[model samples]
Target chain A: MSNITSQRSAPFVVAQIRQDFPILKLKVNDKPLIYLDNAASSQMPQQVIQRLVDYQTNEHANINRGVHYLSETATLRFEEARGKVQRFINAAETREIIFTSGCTESINLVMHGYGRKFIQAGDEIILTVLEHHSNIVPWQMLAEEKGAIIRVVPINDAGELLIDEYQKLFNPRTKFVAISHVSNSLGTVNPIREMIKFAHGHKVPVLVDGAQAVPHMSVDVQDLDCDFYAFSGHKLGGPTGIGILYGKASLLEAMQPFKGGGDMIAVVSFAKTTYNHIPHKFEAGTPPIAAAIGLGAAIDYLLQIGMVAIAEHEHQLLEYATAQITKLAGVTIIGRAKNKVAVISFVVADIHPHDVGTLLNLDGIAVRTGHHCTQPLMHRLGLSATSRASFAMYNTFAEVDALVAGIVAVQQVFAGSM
Target chain B: MSNYKDLYQEVILDHNKKPRNYGQIEKATHQAAGHNPLCGDHLQIALELNQDLICAIGFSGESCAICKASASMMTVAVKNKTRADAEALIQEFLALAKGQLNAIDLIQIGRLAVFAGISQLPTRVKCAILPWHTLHAALNSGAETSTEAEHDPMRTTIGGA
Candidate 1:
């Protein structure tokens, strides 16, 4: 495996990696597809796709509480996938990894299972402004139901969180802290390890939303010492409708189940019922079997490539793209944080981002254009929406050139009309 | 997908760059704000009605070239026309933009003929029609049409009255 960080002299062979993804061969609007919408959903490689196909073909069975041949095999594979996820995130144990539908459901599970039980009236929950609506709305619902207060950590002009204000928000009433490991809209990589340390000192457990972070860089739940970490598999080149929520074993044992079903209960009767242990307690029903296995395959694929290499390549791409886009006459790049992922959001000479997205699509460059499920963040930045181009390990520098050319064409269309 | 040139024609861009009647009308008879939460396109339409005929009309907002140009052309097209005539023209223009109407006389549309290119870009039809919807809301005295319940094809309707 190539380590782009340590072996800085060697160039990342993006063309070789692009070959692994069959979708890269597709064309849209008579042009080669330049997928810059990885932040929205990354494309799956052949390995994960094949894994899903293999699961459906030979090993199709409902897992847990099965005695038949295929059923036992499916259960073993599902448990093996959980172990893979445990190793992927450096979790303490496989029992700490609970599979949910996606990042939204994972967060909602925490809110309902833990939050509804522990959080009390007038208790303060600390959150950051750059959170996706998924993270914010669930907590807001909790706060509303419990009569709890929610305090936000503001961001500077460059979209980095104000660490000084975040610490000040901590007090006796502070019960929890939920922050994103990376901003999906702005691409700011928040210092989670340090933030978690601060929250731990105040005895407040923190939940790191790692949906955007897990795909870009290596994430270790044990290293961060976060109480919980949530991420979606689809954003990491795995199948959709599957996600992982890594919680501390002690915390998972204490929290109530988010839902009740056949699998999550050890024993059920008319009057008395006992819940299952740790992970099984959280995952209620027959989960997305193929997607979990596919996510395991995705983890294997990512490990083979090495995350440090992906991060380094994506960083170079971001640098190259930022340099190129900054040179454009009317383009203004948003979120200039010192530490960022491979996402770039920008505006062009007061042009609406929708127009930019539409024009980019003509060149077969797919970029996201909207508030990006971060409405409050958009309001904080004084922007209604922005055109965002996010990169993955498979993206080439040539695709960045295509994006710039597409943007220039958009400007020319406006200028020539004048 | 539609060709980029057809959606962003020279006329549309020209109007976008230098939109006519693109300011607030002071002491207007009726005014309303419109927003497209889908794209965050927001516009405010103010109308000065002289009995049933529109005396003066102006708009202000931050939106796409299609929307701005459409608003600019709408104000010019509807000014001095009676409320009934303006409503009729708006229906024809929207139908033409949606590609439902094959052909319409340019004379009837006036300068609004530039919006015929909207038929090509289905996704952008909202940008072309948002201004007219805002105007409709303003003229009808708080009659707002919410698009939240509509199906996928009509999901991009202008939000708020």
Candidate 2:
């Protein structure tokens, strides 16, 4: 409520923005859709959709290898998309951006390419309790393989990381730190810049999982000085099967290539094979060209709307939703971190989150239920699961009201049954 | 909403609120665990078998209404039936839930027919059938404990049974 006036002044024209996403008009169970599962994946705007169609219809071809006209056009557009991503995150150079399948693959690439090469037995890698399985499992796999120990930074009940404990986790054997910029499960936005700076003080290279961060805020890789950053395209209003991993030039040069394929090598012979340069060295096969371009277009759309305005609008929505939901009896909101994005995870008294989700779906309100791929986090929080309503830029205040009503209806259904 | 009414029928709701045979069976001869990865539902089913017949059955776990209700009705449906008959009932129940077997098949299942509407909820079909699956595993393996694989319901093809 304090920042409500300023937030309203921000250039967030929700009605106009909602018109761009065709899927928002969809009806579910004979009711108007109120999609609040943005944390899972944001809906694509018509501009990005058209860009994808335009790419496929006219500019489609296998990039990097062909000398044909379509191939050249595709290659140029794909690389330009890389440059767009370069500026979107404000990375040092375009060469730092490596395209992969999604955030999961991006992390796996780092774990294999960098962790296998640099980390030694008995070395420690620091991670946090807020990590998604994509961030945790890859490191666990590497730790098991290399006999490395993983030190986890625990969280408070509010779901904020313990900075003091994080500082203590570092020692001479600590070679790497992998952390998320935001918690996808609880919407807790971590103090990534401070964490990255602290890790740097210990000479530990840090990898920031921006899958949940990039779509919500303006992130400058150079400003954070993170050694590596990764995010998924689908979560950023683009198509799936596309993601980017940004690593410093020095780090990329030192690490081995993740996947060996046709496009990854500069020269290949029966006797020997020479690998290609930085970005192409990681992008092994024919990449998702249309998705890459679509992501670039998505970036363009976000830029036009302005990240500051988007953040402000979503913050307002989060505040509004939190206040409204908090007023309801028997509803417990999880993860009350002071700094959070627009996600709200809550459990209704004596009701299973699965039932809540199913019942809410009947009201045409979509939410995510379950542990949200953060089983360890859920275990740490002493919750088996939660129903999460996450907001995006196009989501309206009225939609939040719809969600509250949906919850009330769900409660009625459960209460009456009892 | 009406479509959902078919899934969360009155019988299912009543059973969920006060599930039958809801506690552990300490002297059970067979036992198995069922897990729904999507919703984080955990159920452990134990059966006391006298010869080939299910003499006593109990389950203990935290699960959704669909799962709890399905387990409540399933224990009642298969109790005192021979292992072979129980297995047949399990198959028939799953077939009915997946819409493979029509409502006409419910005559054989008795009160368990309340779960026939489960065919409408493709996602919750797993919740309805998890107990039956656990029972099948317990009766077949003869092991002290059997566990289902962690399945992503979103990726699972409905009626794939």
Candidate 3:
């Protein structure tokens, strides 16, 4: 609480948070690292790091297997972490949460398992132009394999999905509607709840890629009634190589297991192999135990600060950055959606995004440049790529000011030469 | 913010703004396109060779400052040099950009030294190397190669020669 207040007052709270991540303290060209590429991955907090260290040191046992005390203790902690994630996203049951390597694996799990079992030839999978390649490529592969067609919901010049166009893309053949809750490239907070409900009306299953959204807002999978919700831990102040895939229990019971292995099955006889129930059925082999514990710690950290407060703080930062950067000449923000998370993608007129990113780095300000793993969106926007500044709870308004100053420097450097 | 000034030197920005030989070359004998799909950087390097010595070199595409400037400087550096010299320069420049070498004495190659700062950014190494990678590919393909560079390592695997 006090930490959050102190964090709000400073423009460079990320530098403080950077100290919590031991790697962030490392000098890059004798300059303090200003990591603004939260969308790619976030710096892990000290709590999360400690949690991983403690888990491996003290609770280093395989879960749900051995009858020994260590095994039982490990199982309890793992399941407890699952429960925390269930609560974090407000999912109906712990069984709905399946841990994976990351968001890409989670999306692949859904696309390969559920998509293979349900989708038929000629069926349409409705996606948006604004999805990250992780969300789009798996479905594209599934569609190609299943003889299904993909129908994309177009976005406006502002990068907001055209709701009316999305509605039109819907039909009986639209078996699944997979969309990102927030655009990784554009930072548009899509009306996913409404979109999910509309898809439900047509009896279409909807999978929400909450990788970007879950870190920024309060996500209630049950309330949204989305068929599936997926996110990565690294984006939310947790360790890498860990993610959550939340499916409705009913759907989980129906879908086939994505990978076959020891933990995912009940009995493995030569004659017949019985699979495990719900969550375990999808979690094959030895899971990322330390990373899961780190995610739990990250969730605990966020809960202690409160998601509402974090969201409010981020919204303020986004507003400040947007207002300031928009004032710069030749700067055109890609997405101007009414509702959005903390990402802002823009291009400074003749200056390329990579150039903007490079120049900004000199100011100890980090940002993502180029298409942001959203090449289709770049094609839709009719641009090569845009520089993106994504915010997290630790990010501050002063960092936003630094970003503006960096852009101004870029303008001067290029303008003088021109 | 303190001393990273070398990373964004004035010369790099100058070249980025007013790029040299930025358009397509007419009747290019060899050409290759390179794309950094990660950053959406697309560059087409065109070479006009008269026998062994390079007669003209041109490029056309959109990319970041490091890549565009590198490409701009590369075109100027390779012009009138032997094909083998151009290939060797590409290797030297690649090594220099990676900071494997302290300094590269390529006659008049200047400001390219600024990209030495890019090696400090592990993620951006691809953005800096894209044009050179493309030039390498175009030279290897042996096709009448036009408008296509070798396959980008960032996008595709480079197969056996």
Candidate 4:
């Protein structure tokens, strides 16, 4: 529960949280692992892991089926998890939450369930340059299928979206807006609530990709009024293969079912078929029951520790890391957005990010190095790739120090040869 | 994983710093580009062949040290050698980098043997072998971007880079 409130705070509660994640103690290359790839996927805590073990141990059964004890119990637990997600994001109702495989699938679901149903030829879908491929590609597929035009909102030099350009892109033909809550590559936190409000002003439904944001800060779908909010469970310290898509009740009711299966339909026959209600209509086949329950446990863990504390600790890490990395010569940190998560992406002199990442691994540091599935953003920045070190609540300042030293060592390795 | 010391030895680093024949050749007899979409690596290989002998060879690209070094060493290894020799060496070098060669082939590889560590670094195998892929493409007038079906290890796996 103790978040590092100050820079170099000696007493920290994060150390206790780190104890809850067994993987943090692992060593690589004869050194303690410095996992800075949290943006890629956050590690699971013991609480969530144990929840999975308990579920598989006793509550194993196919949900939404037989009247057997295990089946009913499993179905109850699954619905309970959905309720937890409803409360977690402040969704208006549990029926509005549809479980998917991941954030990508959630976005694809909206594209299939809502987009395919509404979008038409010549309709313009507004997106942003900072969006990960997950957000962009699905819309592109929809546009390609429907002959809809896709317009992108440009970003400023510091990686902040040009709000003017965003609003300018909105017009009578603009039908949908999809934006990320946080930039996976740069850590830029877009003002989703304001952006959603602007989209709503045009009466265009917006989908907020909160996969990167939810892990760092608190999110309220009702407050944002975003028609659809999607995130991956893995990014939120839960198991993979499970995610939640929170859609407005009216929107959920209006959209078509994303997939066809036994649970999604009330009745089926060769002659005619009738679909089921809202959530079940969207959740098609057998869902990832264990992962859903585990995500609920993760929410409990986060609620117990508190998001404000998590955000505060991660911000301090970002501040300290930025200051430390900025002091190093021949290093340039990309994405200097005024508002950001605890992700620092940078370049070392002229060294390729792949090289920097490899050398860092020698010191047991794990950082992501690539376009980060944001190729369009990379094109806009005029860089092929960057090295990104993303912090989680479990990360410590000492790990940040290790990352800096690792970078320095990497530079030395290349510099000596040069 | 191979130690960084072995993976990026002096020869590899020296070539990366001052790569030999690190530029395009005008009116080259053959040319091609290699791309690793996973990590955004690119390199152009151009060679001039006259009467079954490689008279000139050059390359240029934005890639990691392993790739650049391999390209640099490849040009030095094959230049002025016969077309048959260069093509045979290319086969040997590819096998060596993939760790598919025997002791005799390793010895036959000579200076190009530095990339043997690439086989152990699964994530970086593309970076080390990309140049040869381009060279193979250039010699055969193959596609503009010779990915060698890179497998893009990054694509098959999820989580982390």
The residue-level lDDT of candidate 1 at B5 comes to 69
Backbone clash total for model 2 is: 0
lDDT of 3 by residue, A301-393 (tens): 777666777788889989999999889888998899999999888988877887788777766778887778888888988887888888887
Spell out the clash pairs found in candidate 2. Answer: none
Q: Which regions of candidate 1 fall more than 4 Å away from where they truly are? A: A1-12, B1-4, B103-122, B143-161
TM-scores of all candidate predictions against the true structure: 0.93, 0.95, 0.89, 0.95
Stretches off by above 4 angstroms in model 2 are: A1-10, B25-27, B144-161
TM-score of each model's B chain? 0.83, 0.85, 0.79, 0.84
Q: Per-residue alpha-carbon lDDT of model 1 for A284-403, expressed as tens digits?
A: 889999999999999888877878889989999999999999999999999999999999999898678988888888889999988999999999999998999999999998999999
Give the C-alpha miss distance for residue A164 in model 4, angstroms.
Answer: 0.8
- Predicted complex 3: CAPRI docking category: medium
In model 4, where do residues sit more than 4 Å from their true spots?
A1-12, B102-107, B148-161
| Ten contiguous residues minimizing lDDT sum, candidate 1 chain A | A1-10
Number of the candidate with higher DockQ, 1 or 3: 1
What is the lDDT, from 0 to 100, of the residue A317 in candidate 4?
A: 97
- Each candidate: what lDDT? 0.87, 0.88, 0.80, 0.87
Backbone clashes in model 3, listed as residue pairs: B32-B148, B32-B149, B33-B148, B33-B149
